[model samples]
Target: MPDKPRVILDSKQLELTINRLCYQLIENHDDFANSAIVGLQPRGVYVSKRIHEELAKMTGNKNIRHGALDATFFRDDFRTRETPRIPDVTELNFNVENLKVILVDDVLFTGRSVRASMDALLAFGRPQLVELLVLIDRRYTRHLPIMPNYTGKMVNTSLSERVSVEWKETEGKDCVKLHTVKK
Candidate 1:
């Protein structure tokens, strides 16, 4: 039999986490006039979009600007990987110049993605600040010194374990899980 996945957050918990995250974001960025929410592609896009929608609904501001960023080319391991990776769609219409940018993603692993995201974001105008938001913070796995400014959950796992986040946009349900191979 295959290794069973351990549930970290169920649908209810996921919703609550999202709502809490939205509230914390509002607490930090009231009205969000000087802030921009950018989601990392392709999995991070779901969390980013969810945050954008919830934050807009919470604040009743339809003009909350949200964008999607792809970090395929900016990744340090892209060229070194055996298989070639395809770039995803990047859709950021608004400029990030001098604005506080919140980078949203599903999980924070080795911190390489966040580093790559910073490089990718620099293609656009420079932002006054950039903060990271992740649904799951995998602690003690940082290949680089990166931490999430806003996190839904923090978990400690061994190197052999993997953390997976699923969303309704892609997985038809929202949940977080830890997966480990059966020895």
Candidate 2:
């Protein structure tokens, strides 16, 4: 049988983590004058939107450049998956050329999404810098050499487990959970 879901971050804890992440982003990208936050499409948008909103509230930069990227087609496994994938809308209104960019996502699983995001981002324009921000970083499972510059939490998991970030926007709550798959 599958293991019961484990709560990694509750609502209050999730809020605190996000607050701390926003401050960290501010510390590194002061003024955010030339930096943009791009949320990976699908699930990552929830975390990115929240981060963008928090950053605006804390930095008072109501004009922060935040956009969503859909890397469905850019994924390396796009042609290998048995199920077809539907593409999401990409709405990056600002140019990333010569700018610093932070890629945001709810969870960093195998790093494939991040890789695809980077590839998808290139179509916009080459940014001066590229960093990653994730609500949950699942260690030891990365197939690619990718890591988050800003992470809310780092978790160690096995191949039989999965970590997911739930947002109130879509899941009715803000929490992180780890699920175990039956072998």
Model 1: colliding residue pairs = none
Positional deviation of 104 in candidate 1, in angstroms? 0.3
State each model's CA lDDT, in order. 0.92, 0.92
> Which window of ten consecutive residues has the lowest lDDT sum in model 1?
165-174
For each candidate, what TM-score against the reference?
A: 0.96, 0.97
Instruction: List model 2 lDDT by residue over 1-183, tens digit each.
Output: 878999999999999999999999999999999999989988888888999999999999999999999998888886778998999999999999999999999888899889989999999888999999999998999999998999999999998998888888788998999999998
Q: Under the 3 Å rule for N, CA and C atoms, how many clashes does model 1 have?
A: 0
